[model samples]
Target chain A: MTETESPTGSTLTIGVVKETKPGERRVALVPKLIERLTRRGLKVVVEPGAGAGAQLADDVFTEAGATTGDAWSADIVLTVVPPSIADIERLKPGTVLIGFLAPLTNTDEVAAMKKAGITAFAVESIPRISRAQGMDALSSQANVAGYRAVLLAAQRLPKFFPMLTTAAGTVPPAKALVLGVGVAGLQALATAKRLGAQATGYDVRPEVAEQVRSVGAQWLDLGIEAAGEGGYARELTEEERARQQQRLTEAIGGFDVVITTALVPGRKAPTLVTAEAVRGMKAGSVIVDMAGETGGNCELTDPGKDIVAHDVTICSPLNLPAEMPVHASELYARNLTELLELIVDTDGKLAIDFSDEVVAGACVAGRDEEVN
Target chain B: MTETESPTGSTLTIGVVKETKPGERRVALVPKLIERLTRRGLKVVVEPGAGAGAQLADDVFTEAGATTGDAWSADIVLTVVPPSIADIERLKPGTVLIGFLAPLTNTDEVAAMKKAGITAFAVESIPRISRAQGMDALSSQANVAGYRAVLLAAQRLPKFFPMLTTAAGTVPPAKALVLGVGVAGLQALATAKRLGAQATGYDVRPEVAEQVRSVGAQWLDLGIEAAGEGGYARELTEEERARQQQRLTEAIGGFDVVITTALVPGRKAPTLVTAEAVRGMKAGSVIVDMAGETGGNCELTDPGKDIVAHDVTICSPLNLPAEMPVHASELYARNLTELLELIVDTDGKLAIDFSDEVVAGACVAGRDEEVN
Candidate 1:
């Protein structure tokens, strides 16, 4: 596949630098991506120890036909994490840098990226679609976050989830209920069920009931009906909300572990589980709210901390994906590689054509001056 | 049934109290329980306007055969949320107090419950079993919490979850992943699905893959075997932990929402999702960590706050369940009534039977005082 598509006349140069942040592992460009880049006549340059944490030796870059040199002097700089203001200050204007800048809420970080005069490609900003699936960062890391949330819950939960017939006594299975049905919520349900808990789920969208039922657990519908354009929920009518809550209240008293994941982008999360419900739960019941970063769904939830309310503990953790940085970075790097190839031209030259929907969508935050 | 069991009955005194905590909407005992108590030849006494937030008026309590009076002076004192330390101190010695008392981490509160010499029963400490399920505060409340979490996540999410085919374009369904399969997690999953998102779930327990698949999501297994005695996972082994990371890294990129519910009882929550995972996620993705009350599963999750990292926002909301306190209280009241009826003696009298497993298990937390 690489032979015919190789850029014969020119070779493209991309730079890799050591991440300044302490405890930063994983590089933006991994050695595994070299063959693809080489076939396109794209040459990668790396600073010393760029891939040290990932165990990719310096010689590995050389073996892959990548040049070892002064990283800051390259036409485009590729980084893992975000570069510090000082690092950006050293860069020449019009240079392109690709990595996770955390643009949405990182005012200072986004400004820094802009000030660097570098075109930024947030790997985390990749869209989710069949064509963009390979470059979707949210899925790569959320998968880790979901797996980890369950492990955390299992550790703190007092009793087992599944029922057992023991000689001593009959141990009933734990009833697990999932809220929000998002990536982490689904993972939590799967994890709880795997642990032998009888799983059930609730959602506002009646259409999701099938998905919930497909998971071998009962699908709890609050009888909420909603329709919106382009994968966004139209705001609910107050009456619909009331009916939904009414149904939810009646269905609530049976579960053990309550994992909540509900949120609106760029807004405070709505509350799903109420204090009275927490009080109604069994002793030693546990809840892990994944929306802690945006606010929380459980009344007892305290973002980034642990609080026991009415004997029910609500836990909200931050940076769930980073805890597994090794895999996270690897996945993100692959995504970056895929996204980069699409933007690069056949001449092995840099070209970001925003006319393409994928490029335009991914480049939403960038100003005209940031990229050509 | 009520007429059949009236031979040995005398009017039992039931007491209700106002919560002393700031912004507390929950009353001592709700109307549903009061009706049950009254049916059992119990005279119900409630503080004026006790159930206002719960929408049960004082007239309703009075009409149901309850008397209004100073809750502190009643024969039995019940309050929602938790009583202030001062209220505990003021209670008469040996008076029975029933409410949500967070005992494990609140040593001072536990000490107060003990020092006051009140036979305090933390409603949340109820055991979870077939017979004891009705009394299970954790289950009842978690159900509400789980429902609320999904709403919160949906509200905060940038887009709606369900797919839409409109004149504008084909809007692919938002993708959601759930982390744990506990009650809250399941609810979140169901809610997210209903909101029109493609849902997926993962867990450390392989047994839950079927459940996740049943929920209409393609289940991705981390392939880490669990070692839990009661169908719960013990702390993961170090090697298994690495494998888990690998599994999540492969799966996280496509999700638009992630809900996390992971915790351990009486212990700090294990760090599951890390910052790298957050960075790897898409810019608009939102993560709701339900583990905020415990030390969060996400390393970057801050309890009771909203934070944006790597363009992905993480939220850990505190007291989410309280946001919808009215229904929460109602559900709890029914659960308590069911529980109280289960333990009520045939003589129309309250009985504390330590010999019963339900009572024995329920009497788990608190000041550790014993009363007959």
Candidate 2:
């Protein structure tokens, strides 16, 4: 066996494992990143068919200097979704696991990883500092989801998104309204504008108006300010919520397409498009709820299904990023690459530096004492 | 009784009938057009539920000055599709009928109309002259099909149509190519370009290169010219066809999306994307064949279905314009309005002037002698 294969070898081995989550098509790593890791004197091990969902074959990874072998015993393990309890039992002690570990929600899984002595770094837990921008997988995946949501809305709507002056007559451009101003909402507005739609954005936090305008979209302000800590809008009060819904119902009637992405972290998605709002909209209008997995932001939204209510089509597709596997995986793999560069030493050995805010913020388990 | 109810009255009455063809969602007129027709001093009657498919309610049509009643007994009948044998039997003798009668192919339907002594005007037979441009239903419907085709291709593509630069990385825009730079092809290229794709156009007729360039798309020339009369490319010779296919195979592989709209009147659509070319395309690429009803331009296309072949999605959607009923019906109604102006006198009486070129060309049956 090669010296790199030894359990206590100096050379670090990064293992790429296939995602086991149902309907999850993205991979933790891609073939192009294999060379980036290998150039750092790290040996890369990929499980068979690891990148199949992302359209990256095993032969492509092998051609990029990766070996097809058992990846579970490597020094560093990469994944897309949180590992199952059975998968946690398979990990060796002191293995550095990198992925979206869902540390805040998957309590049992976090406890199981601690029992297994796996040093878990949740990508979602990465501090949203300027330095950790490149390692933010949540933002990267949300960007893809936002772009795909507009295309889905366009496909279901019977009218054209862009204006065209033809021989018969002139067709007016469709009006698109986005109900959130985060990364996904901004990207959705930008994409809708690119397709020649008249795009508008709304958010509880009034500060995001400039960011929305920067993407060539007008901002709809309802005079509510709920800017919470950590870049998320706080839950609105009962009176404010009622007033917002009433204003939104009136505003939504003027739009041909409405994309709702409002979410309160660790809580159910806020209902921005009430059933009354849906009724107010035009017959051929469409609504794409990006927060479908979080119980949707529309009252009429049937999570994970396409349904028509009040003459409006509402598509609440779960895991929208998985539908576009190629680009989604590429961006996620890049995020992992940036994070790996921080935790791996120049000499190709595993080194955990808790002094760094990103490492300290992302680490949830595996220390002499509890780190969570 | 009203003057329009009298058989020998000077007043003229027009009837809008519901389309009976399966999958045809468009109507001959919309509620918005009722006022325009009423202003011409003509009585209008609409069959119940005629505009329902286009999202136009019966109350809306009634509010616009149209009466719901027996439309088949009106002096002139307006429809979107050719009347079936049973429908033709319902028409009054010497009644003026207007729509896409498919005179060139539906011989049985034309014979039935003639046996019933119905004066049939085929919208497809309208002369391609400046004065008749507003009455060209084929061009109007084709434009809708073209715009929808790009949307279909964009929806199926795994990558974004436009280039996106995010915090994680930069994604290049998709390259789209359209075959047959006719009205539909030009619209497809323009739509793709609007969606921020690198668009290209190719046609057998070299004269359309300027038209393609006007849509902000580069034209791909295979050095084959088949320009024919009536603004359609003539059938190519065997040698020319083989050479064009070979060159197209090489060029099509480089595009992320391909939309084919080539057709030769009554002939089957020419194969532009061969099976070999599909195999050469990258994974997750998409192809939309607009000529699915006439046999697709892609060799592997399954007409009226969306299928995956050689890692490429080939969508052969039939009656694409029907999918967007609102705009399709609106445009078609405008075309019929322009045609009605040619036949209806200012006195609000039936006065078919054979001297008019548009009237003479569009007339298919019911005369002292056969006009065909």
Candidate 3:
């Protein structure tokens, strides 16, 4: 955590708990993260071994000057991942718990958090924008996920990606296709290009062709736009899906490796590739679904598993962010630190102004409005 | 069929068959397609009941001056769909058959075409260039697919796409996300923008930001360009995938609807949306996977089916062009006609030029090294 100057005197209490879930090793708050809060007259606490996987120990927390007190004593409890029931019970009413709580998926846990009288903040819900850049835990993690997805595709592919001037016969470059053109898709495209795979991207938005071309791959157009309001995909009609498939069928069966990064916010993913389409591809093609944990983009894909169809391997990794925990954590820390700084007022204090759009948009727990 | 007067002396043969596949009533080739051949002095055969689904009748072929043949015979036999074995066997050795035979998925079947000594041409393989514009079957179908994709998404979504001054109150227009940014993707963007759906697009290629913005949607940059040679998406390194997912996860939960149209040529479609990502999406959100025929970009997608997951509906319909068969077929016919015109000699004679890249690329089946 970097130092933040405070013009006025104020104090904040921050708490940390050891990860309790099986195979869970990430500290809710990291060492540098704790340091950032403490330098600003904020109190920090640790329940021993919080940052063990990250190589920080109890002594490190103490050195940071975080108080080792009962979980309920802190004015604010900093958590890693979501806090478990046992951990939640330890907190007193009205304590603010900040973490990546599974608020949407785990409604029961949200209920528990509300019942315990805790004001909860979900880091995962932070939006991606210039103002919220510092608070985007997902961006940091996704950056890593995109890179990992490409590596996985390369590993699964039988041929090398780049053109090789080897002593043997000159090696032809591999052809790569990026399904989605989002952050992961862009990373996959860049990585594929860097690895020497001829990469092209397809999107329902034709405007991305130039970008795909800019990345050095011919943008294969299958002409299907489902753009709706707010820059999101609209529900497709029955006939339209069929048309897109026809165009896709013409283009889907020529690449050696494909990495997909397309996703709809707050909805089930649309099936871009069908089993029939899979059957059309040549044997030994590899596909990496970065969106696998939610299920997968591939019809034959199994979450957290790799399956083969028509001699092609479809990989769906669930916890891609966890795969590269170090850098992911570092980036996440930076984002969180930035977000926290925004709320810290002129005096060394935290403020949640419900009237502001930023605060109101993220305060989904409904405590302020009692909607939840 | 449009009249083709390019081939004055030389005659080419055309073949037609009644679509046998269920729901496959539209003939792959149409009258306008034959017009160019007729003008090229090509003789064509039509099987009874072809083109009935598209409201075209055998008399339409007869009226076009094409001989209705009991047995398939001709120097060049034009087909709308993949030739059946019986259809293949029906052809004499050294006959030319052209249509979207799907060489990528039907390689083995195509290999059989070679064994049967049938000269085959896959129109879908036409390169993207000004010279090949007339022959670009993909573009023709994609235009329709794009138009249809937008309409589909608009209809399925609960909210209206266009902003309206309605009695129900000034309704905020719907929000949509177009996952892939290809030709179809861009068209979708433009359509969505026109239809009043505020649309945004994501692509691995950074160059597409302008295109997205051009179509009235914001471009979210992921900071990594996976582009390699020719502006194609480069295969990403492992680290990149992680970062990409982290960013996308955050972006995915904010939109109302998503249309994913990501794919690779001759490969299994890459997975874009994860089941986890979908869980964060709101109920009533919709996803249309234009790449559904090639394998879906979504985790919960079942190609050729409609799926409801996490209270969201996912539609992956293959054969989109078939739905708008009239317009799609007409466009395809025009393109075929243009290519045929380009293939004619100054004296209106058929010129199977091996020197021409457009002819060479499109004429996949060769006779003695010459494209013809």
Candidate 4:
């Protein structure tokens, strides 16, 4: 495919940089997406070793028509995470920075972008509206975390996931309980079911019982509903929390594997399994705390460590999406491409409209000098 | 249930001991089988922590009518692996020993059993007849290994095992190859298929092509059959080996995950995947060398360690059954129970008929002092 497509000969230069976040292996874009952007009259430049973490070689990007250059010098710079302050200073004014910027919690990053005159689009801030569903990086990444959590649990569990009948005897299937019915929880439930486990899911929102059943998992009712805005679970009241805890403590003991994915945006994850509950679980049971990085939902979960408390193994895996970099980057890159298609015009110029809900929601900084 | 049940008032004592071999965590018996044996007029004794590795607590064993005692003092001492010399010293004359005694390979252990006057039954030496299938410990453990191999590969590979379609895009299913059609290889093929991988299996014996296809895997006919006696693959001639390697090197490059379980009795495992073949694999692909302890099927596999060669991760896990001790012990304990039932009469006394083929095949050391 040729790089020049527009008759006006107008094109934009886009840059892809290697992420510097510790243990973050995913890239914002891959070579396949670079080819797609370049074929549309967009000049693509990738920093050396930009795709190394995702097992993509530099030569492969070059082969796909991406040139090696200083990523900060391009008209638009793409990254998976927020860039370092030193890297951000290298970008000239009017440069657009696109990434999974945690705008709600990263007050300092939004201020720096505004002061530097860098228009930034936070992919995490993509609205939950149907129109912006294709560009939702948070949901896409969480899907990967959910799938990985099941694999991690299956590997750590002392028994087989599926039931099997041999000449010697028959083995019972493992019972898996997924806490929360978000994108990650749904995926975890589906993955566990696919592995032949008897998957059960719990969510405070009673409405999600159908979604849980749709994924072939039984719904766990704790008799307390905490449905909140934006499809997230609300913080529970003191009395509701005690009731939920009491019910879950008794139910958790029966499961061989437990995966907790209850994370409230910009806040500590709700405690699902307390230390006393861990003691109640069977000896060979395993718990995968998916929200470990944001202060786990399991009280005994030690973030980024595997602990055997009361004979139950608790694996608090952090950054699961990064661990499966190939698929994670592929999904992230596609999300970036869809978002770019929305904001970049046919002439390869910025076409941001303040009236557009997606633009207004995801735009953390712009020419208006708005910091938030 | 009472420990004594037979009208003759004779109850044989069967002991369960903790395996002393390094990295061996499986127990010959579990609490469930203890209840079964005790109900059948078999007095069960267990060493302290005998089933701890298998997640069967001491209280559970006692609840099943088993008493804590020196395992060596029982009428029959059961183990997963051969007992140590120090343990054998504690056994009185005429005590029966049972385990997966690799009699053909471990000449020293066989001699030790004969010299100590320990009548030993080798589970590995059990006849492959249909009637003796319940006593096949080797096949039971291999089944666990095969199932675990796919889980290990899915966890290590940087992609999803099954094909997935989401709002973002579609992920193709992982391609898996099983090099062997034995118990382990068949289980691996079945597991890979269960996980939604497109699986293919290869075997030197053409008769097993149907068995491979039955497990939902495509049969790979290498066009060179080396079917041997006793259900094992025969060693290939020099020229036959060259042709097989040539064809496999080309075929192996196409798979994302390769599980090799080709093992010849009393011999080193065949080299199915060479170093050159690993270089031909995709960067994020994985190879599980199931025969790691007996010299791996992959040339670069380091037994009990994971190595990355040519961007392909090679995992040579040893004793996968021990890693999932709960079911491993359950199957093993049942196998031991079935074997014991064959030798012990209803009166709980030894019934060694020289004409019986099952006993003749499995008896490694007996009153005749025959060691081998």
Candidate 5:
């Protein structure tokens, strides 16, 4: 352990590393967060260009009292995504690595973490409870993705989102249909509504209709309820799926823009917009599939590509949160800060209390082997 | 005359030609308007792929009773842009060519039209009066350009336009500053407001402050009045120009988006956003120069390109109205239809009433040789 003691006390060293994932433009921490951490008696070491993706220059971090250096020697490291195998090898034994570590699907990384004897906390594993709401990084990032998806659709769509009466005639507002009512979906609906688009939202869970209405968007009732545990939609029955698809196909044809955010966690995103439905849409319409990374909710969506289907533009963008990194980083940094307070004790020492529900739930590796 | 006599009467032939200007996507008439023309006992002919840029397939025009043929042989030829020298040569004598002929700037085209003996009506020459409001193509096209400029800025901007309140914190709304309060500038302000941006506008004319305030944007007063004749800003005095530049340079630094639409009709667009002003703007801020074609208002703007200067993305788009061809065409076609009604007689014969103010103002050639 590379622990150093100051005259006042032993300060907890927090390291921020630049994301290595291609097209990942968001940083785990920003310059504003550096002062907040330093004020809490924590020493921050940021790798050069770590916050460049977020448009936060290295000098800005230094101005906020963060030291410019190689952060591999720090006690705790912060990352937005799962670190590469090479990066995992750089960490010292017993070093704590924190991020959206997918311990369920990334078994290889989990095994490597065990071999390296490094403690790992997955932000994705944070319980969706009232107290942990502020620490929910997934929800924070999803909010950004949701807002960006509407803009992408608006930019791609040939028509205006709002209606206007001019000397020539009145141009009607664009009709938008949003699939799913999660954090990302709600934000998309709110953004579309704000842009003056007549927005409608659909979710498998019937209870989210009220949330959709709260954002000034109409609720699309499919007449089927599939609300699952933990606020996720359950896998639908064959009959229910067929009926849902039929209703969506008929309803989606009337919309000028469609934003799909339906995801089943680690599973493939459900097909909400079929090829026939896309063909039925008016020419020059736009569809933005937010769940493109794990197989899109649209049948015709090509991940990371803008494709035209029957004259309708379908954009399957990956890492939308990264595209607007300034605010994205700010939100993510705050989430990590809240989570850090829970993981660290008052003496500036790492304390993983297994008895604490949040600690037990978010702990992916480091505790005795019961993690997925 | 290429008039074909039907059993009912001798019908007028209205021809639509493809625009030759590079990056010009708008067609003079869409398929939707073809039916309106044909209903007035008029024969409609469309050149192959004339409406393709506007996403209206040739079959759609044919379905609306328009025949695919060479438009040059028709008595009345409609175009979106001024005809090329070669196109002028193809026109028969007494042919009526209608479009936004830059009568003031294109001296060669005006002389060519006179030599060819073609009756030309420039849409840009249409007088801005109450009765001619429906025929104002400049205002119609400029409206589309302004709305599109905001969308372009929003797409390129790294942050959200609206004030978003999330669990992490509240992200303040993006501040947008629009220079000039013409039809385009006003539309841009409204669009930015619709997107939830806190928009501010600056104009040399003091009277347009009410127009800016009407769109819910704060009026930026440079304390120098340069309101000129015909509703355009006059040439600013050197001392007044200096004061305006100084105030703008300081004010522009605070805005996230700056849209400059200051154009003096025939003269080179006034340099509104200087290089020093651009350098003072925040990094990742956007500047959309709407007066790009008539020599940009921003010093750093390279027409038809997106350049980053002092960390600010300056987009000088060429033909923004063409990018949104669907509605742009609809509005332009309506303007042309209203203008056509004034020039064409009740007996379905070509008649140029030089005594009518709308006709006299719109006529660029054929009302004696001195019209150009």
Candidate 6:
């Protein structure tokens, strides 16, 4: 294997294609990363207007050593979203595809890629081990979503987040409670605290209390610890669920803003904010339900809508990272770059070692049935 | 005069009227202040749904020692906006009225109140003195507008306001600039800083440099000063204005967010942000023009509307205080209460003292020829 040589002794080409999903403004590769790929003797081809959504013009990509061409015909295709079935038909048998292919849920897409004999990598399927942390696109995008959720809540709430002493009187700081102290929830708490709100974080996993406090927010303990394997809370027992709901309902009323980010990998999001809890909240308070895509953490949440229930604004924005396309695309590109470094050999030849845990875990198609 | 007696030997009746102006959600009084008025032996009457916009139900006011009735018929009418001609006609000849009368601009409204023999006190006309600071409704409302402007800018921006270090990469903090150093501008700078943005403030009045720095923002010095009378900047000379604009255009390009609050009394807002400046800014940058009601400080601003010009979002929301009706009403009610304490004698009878500077300055009508 040599620089600029693929397994078949031809120049290896990485293609950056424009995202086709509706409202998906992020791009998988940014111009800033073009040099890194090209420096390794990889030829870069970007479809015209591929990075437009992320504010990178075609000229910028061209200036960064990328050529405008048919990206679908390249050796490897980079995308923000999973390619459609029609897009899969455009790729050669040995072509490699990489992006957020929902392997667990979009089984049909995975089967289609397998039938086409295309090697595919699902960013969401990347292992959570220490070595693969830089390739964790889910956590990177969730960080953006969490930060955006707080800004949306602040914009909609008819009050100041921080306390202020003016000529008329002093206004007390708004109290914000974040349910589920995952990466997104912790980021939401940090953002709220940055805006001068008195922030509090709650999670069924008691171990996350220290992480919440590190962001300058209080930790709410409800005495329900469901620390499950793989860093997720276990499904609560029937009795535990009832107790959690009652305690959360009582505690929610005291906060002016609430952000819910509890989500199960392959299950509907748990209903953390019930209708009764919403009714008890003060008028003009805000709730940003980050689990809107998975049936929402709030009982009254209408996915991808902003509604007022019981005089409280409930915002359930889907794909919040797309709303902030520039930074979201930049981070996603970096995550892809880290993953690329693992699969691409030091000599710049196409090489995928299945023995590597990250490479094996992220592969969804074009592998032996037993290995898969 | 007795505690329960008016000039006409009747109980002093203070009425809280529902604001009739379009999009004006704030009421003249809130339920929390009802007991304060009643404790002075004054009878309080609230129009039905007067505090609805502020989330204070009619029953809440009634529970706080107020009665639901025809607010227009009370001896003293309290309002959030200047009353219309039809409303003035409903008032008794000797009735006292107070609110943001816009005495200098809305001359016809003042003349109508005078012709109807109603004693009108424009909150905007309140003298800027230490004793009258609590009665300065303009300052109070401006503070809310300033705080909201930053939030609006943050929401519209596609990037995070604060810097973040993640596994993917580090995001630099957003740079925010505020043009004007008045109450609203100062608050805008403080709020932007609170959200962790690198904030800078610019003002024609060089004296406000200290106030800008006190809010944790750098002062942009253009080497041109226009210190005017009565705590406002004077009109800049043509040469100085050209020099200022040229310098500002260069400085504005470096900021991600710009909030403009530069306005002259009874005149169109100065063009602090030119069209060229908007074009010079990076794509997805935001500009919130707080001077929208008096035209805008931005060349491309559409007053009372949110529009994008030259790839920059320009939000010129009018009456921002009304958008946050809860705190806006609370602060305005407190300001009115402070003014009421000055006019309402210890015996609880109406005392019109022209000798007092605040009273004389605030009185827009119902005074003798010279005193007015």
Best by TM-score: 6
User: What lDDT does model 2 reach?
Assistant: 0.88
Off by over 4 Å in 2: A1-11, A367-372, B1-11, B367-372
DockQ class, candidate 5: medium
Instruction: Looking at model 3 chain B, report the run of 10 residues with the lowest lDDT sum.
Output: B1-10
- Tens digits of lDDT, candidate 6, B219-251: 999999999987879999999999999999999
Off by over 4 Å in 6: A1-9, A369-372, B1-8, B369-372
Instruction: Write the residue-wise lDDT of candidate 1 on A37-113 in tens digits.
Output: 77877778899878765546688888987989877766667777667778878777666677776666665766876
The digit string of per-residue lDDT tens for model 1 on B90-171 reads 7777556677777666668767777777666677666556666656666556655655666566545544344433211233
Model 4, C-alpha of B22: deviation from truth (Å): 2.2
Distance (Å) between predicted and true CA of A144, model 5?
A: 1.5
Best by DockQ: 4
lDDT to native, each model: 0.66, 0.88, 0.66, 0.87, 0.87, 0.89
Highest lDDT among the candidates is held by which one?
6
Q: Give the TM-score of candidate 6.
A: 0.96
Task: Give all TM-scores, in the order shown.
Answer: 0.50, 0.95, 0.48, 0.95, 0.95, 0.96
Report how far off residue A123 is in candidate 2 (Å).
1.7
Residues A1-372 of candidate 6: C-alpha lDDT, one tens digit per residue: 112345577778998988888888898998899888888888899999888777778998999899999999888999888788887888887778999988877888889899987889999898888988888999989999999999889887777888878777888989999999888999999999988899999999999999999999999999999999777899999999999999999999999999999988878999999999999999889999999989999999999999999989999998899988888898899999989887887667877878788888999997674245
Q: Model 3: which docking level applies?
A: incorrect
lDDT per residue (tens digit) for residues A176-275 in model 3: 8888776567666866775457888877777667777775766767767766643345767878878876776557788878777767665566666778
Per-residue lDDT over A248-288 for candidate 5, one digit per residue giving the tens place of the 0 to 100 score: 99999999999999988778989999999999998889999
TM-score of chain A of each: 0.81, 0.96, 0.86, 0.95, 0.95, 0.96
Q: What would the per-residue lDDT of candidate 5 be over residues B1-372, giving only the tens digit for each residue?
A: 122233244676888998888888889998887766776667888999898778788899999899989988677889998888888898887778899888988889889998998878999998888899999999999998999999899888888888988776788999999999999999999999988899999999999999999999999987989989877899998988888898899999999999999999878999999999999998889999988889899999999899998889999998888888888898899999888777665556666677789888988876774344
Local accuracy of candidate 2 as per-residue lDDT tens digits, A1-372: 011223765678899988888989888888888888998899999999888787788998999999988888888999998999988887898788999898877999999988888889999899999999999999999998998899898888888788867777888989999999899999899989988799999999999999999989999988777888889998899999999999999999999999999988777999999999999988879999999888999999999999989779999999988888888899999999999988886667666778789988999887544344
